[model samples]
Target chain A: MDKEYQIQGTRMKFWMPKEVDHHKAAALRDQLDRLIEMHQIRELILDFSETEFMDSSGIGVIIGRTKTIGFYGGKVEAVNLSAQVKKICCASGLHRLINIREVAENDG
Target chain B: MTDKKTNHMHLYFDARSVNEGFARMVVSAFLTEMNPTLEELSDVKTAVSEAVTNAIVHGYSTEAQQVELICDRNEDELTVTVSDRGVGIADIPAAMQPFYTTKPEQERTGMGFAFMEAFMDEVRVESVPGEGTRVTMKKCIGRENGR
Candidate 1:
């Protein structure tokens, strides 16, 4: 079984699936919740390099994680968002809360 | 409604979350023949996913039920209707309000309908309590031809 996330120091990077919707949101949320509980995570990096499709459910997951980590003054950063995901995020006002970063070709 | 041609399709599937990807794939595939721009395609996919998720989460409350997707394409416009025969919304206006979610504890941002409105050219919602809810959204694709 492939782990859905990886923890590195104070930053936990989550590799989301290609499709993010209501069906997969719950499981993803649970996994993230458990990880947050076990680790002293201060930065949640949502790596969207592998994600092609994201809907409101994806937004829900990000918001939920943001609130959860906000308790510890943790911040969430979204990286490598495709144009489609970026449009949705802009419309949902997510850019106001999270730092949206661009990924370079060599930046794995 | 464009003047070139018209195509229609209907799909019925379980309200499981797994099918959300299925719904997006099917709709995108169906629209491929129209040669929609990437943005146009993504807009439709996002709108469809939001409507379908609402039906699965709010309409059926994640229980075992059925969600139906009906799509109509005419010229450069694609119309999609996602419906579910589950608990209907009592106050649709309230439901459409930004940041008004019934399941906030579940991390629902109450932005489902908002996303639909933002992505699609037109969005219309209708529901009857204890019966079902239907979300109809339309978008003009093929932006290359200046649609």
Candidate 2:
């Protein structure tokens, strides 16, 4: 499986795809979980710079991963969210579950 | 005042997860003539995606089936309906409730109906216990500021 994530020490930053519907969310879920386990990820950062669309399935992917890593007090942060994605994150009550950063600090 | 043209389309495809994006694209493409705003297009696409995903994930549930998508535009109002002849819902009210999902293991957030209702002007669901489910949603374009 092609890795869609980057790992540095205990942190993993995942690059979200352009469209995050059920089909893509499923694949992302599996890959993200596997990467989290393999790398023992503690801090997960979802980079939404490329995401233009997202539905409830994408919300499920985020919540599922949050629960997985939350068991060990791991944190999940989302960055560079677009207007459409921000609305979804708030509407699904995901804004409270994870930290959403409007701009990436390092600009990588 | 020139009369606005009315248009309609019917789409039938396999109830597979892969077609979810195709359904959204078709609906957006169909609405291009209306000159929808960016937010308007995004809202419709999101709602359509939710409805189609529900049919494939909940209605069919691993069984290969057919999903039907119909869209009609009369004036500025757009109507979209997605239907499936697979296993239907036992209680639509319970199903529409936020955070109520039968496939928790699959990580379903159960917010499908909610998103449709939120983004669209109106949403209606019809289902027969053992028959199937049809979701119809309506939205009025170019009226965001007026509303």
- DockQ, per model, reads 0.83, 0.90
Off by over 4 Å in 1: A1-4, A104-108, B1-4
lDDT of 1 by residue, A20-55 (tens): 888788888988888888887888888888888988
How far residue B119's Cα lies from its native spot in candidate 1, in Å, is 0.6
For candidate 1, give the lDDT of residue B50: 86
The collision pairs in model 1 are: A23-B17
Question: What range of 10 consecutive residues in model 2 chain B has the weakest lDDT sum?
Answer: B56-65
lDDT of each: 0.87, 0.92
For candidate 1, give the lDDT of residue A53: 90
Clashing pairs for model 2 are none
Q: Summarize candidate 2's per-residue lDDT along B41-137 as a digit string, tens digits.
A: 9999999999999999988866578999999999889999999987899898999999999999889999999999999999999999779999999
Give candidate 2 regions above 4 Å deviation: A1-3, B145-147
Looking at candidate 1 chain B, the ten consecutive residues that score lowest on lDDT are: B138-147
